[model samples]
Target: MDQTTTTTAKKVLCIEDEHFIGELYARALTKGGYEVKVVIDGSEGLKEARTNQYDIILLDLMVPNVTGMEILKQLRDPSQPALKAKIIITTNLEQKEETRTAIEQQADGYLIKAEVTPKQLVGILDTLN
Candidate 1:
């Protein structure tokens, strides 16, 4: 008799323009038993997020082509199909008080890039559920 248990790894999409930060997140999340896909631009990130295939999405505010703020708005729009993935804002840039409040209200989580370590990021993901 053989007893084997197979658990699917949680899928994580990391949208960060900083190559180093993206890589760091990919490595940490992978090590934490998640399948991670890192995209360096907001255009690609928005495209991927629209698929609604991931369980978690780590988004950065500033990126090429499109901004993360726009992506979040689109995802949260009632006109579009709802997304199952939780969107977490990961950014170093500071926004206005009102803007920050608005974003925090929409996002599942928010973290400062300079304050959070890659390992801490993985831990944060674990707590999201």
Candidate 2:
């Protein structure tokens, strides 16, 4: 395979509250060749989600100022272009109800923080339609 082939990199936006997790995820996505941006709070995350174009979104369930559910709710509005992006939930919370909520909000996938690594997440993105 020619390493120089032109493959348009995908854009990814990660919404996370924890400092370490944000850096970890961003670094991983960057290494995976995606243009990745990290926002620490749901409000700021929501703002970025509204103002930008992304191929996918990684949303943490719990955050300050706003929760992931709130962000998902706002993004689901038909007027937002980002709503078309595949939304992936990343959270330590693995409750069935939370997963159901994420699904209802149109999430493409859900990842339990403790069970997933950056490499694995990138692999998931590779399998997307």
Candidate 3:
């Protein structure tokens, strides 16, 4: 029998306000062979997103200090032009208008948090790769 090993782990940034949700996602993603970073504060998450390159970012819309829309705007801004991380909005917000706006802002994907389990989320990320 032969075994294959992966040399690199996919990096994931989870910007979620709920501590339990964050931990759940981090644990699930880690189990799925990803390097996960969870930030409960939107401002700090935004700062980190702007500075580091990740394979994917799981963002929540209603977070403390800064809105996820604002973070998306900054990340998609043509002025910066260097941030290329794929951003996926994982929020409980269920508004068609907001979804449209997120799509317009170049969000890679959107998911209703209430509808997705951590394992399902990992499956989605796998498709992206």
Summarize candidate 2's per-residue lDDT along 85-116 as a digit string, tens digits: 88988888756786586566577788888898
lDDT of 3 by residue, 39-76 (tens): 98989999999788898999898899998888888888
Candidate 2: 10-residue stretch with minimal lDDT: 76-85
Per-model TM values vs. the true structure: 0.94, 0.86, 0.90
lDDT of 1 by residue, 7-92 (tens): 89999999999999999999999999999999998888999888749999998989889999998888889888888999999999
Look at candidate 2 and give me any clashing residue pairs.
none
Candidates' RMSD to native: 1.2, 2.8, 2.2
Measured by TM-score, the strongest candidate is 1
Instruction: Point out where model 3 deviates above 4 Å.
Output: 1-6, 96-99
Query: What lDDT score is found at residue 47 in candidate 1?
Result: 93
After TM-score superposition, what is the CA distance of residue 102 in candidate 3 from its true location, in Å?
4.0
Q: Which 10 residues in a row give candidate 3 its minimum summed lDDT? A: 95-104
TM match of model 1 to true structure: 0.94
Ranking by TM-score: 1, 3, 2
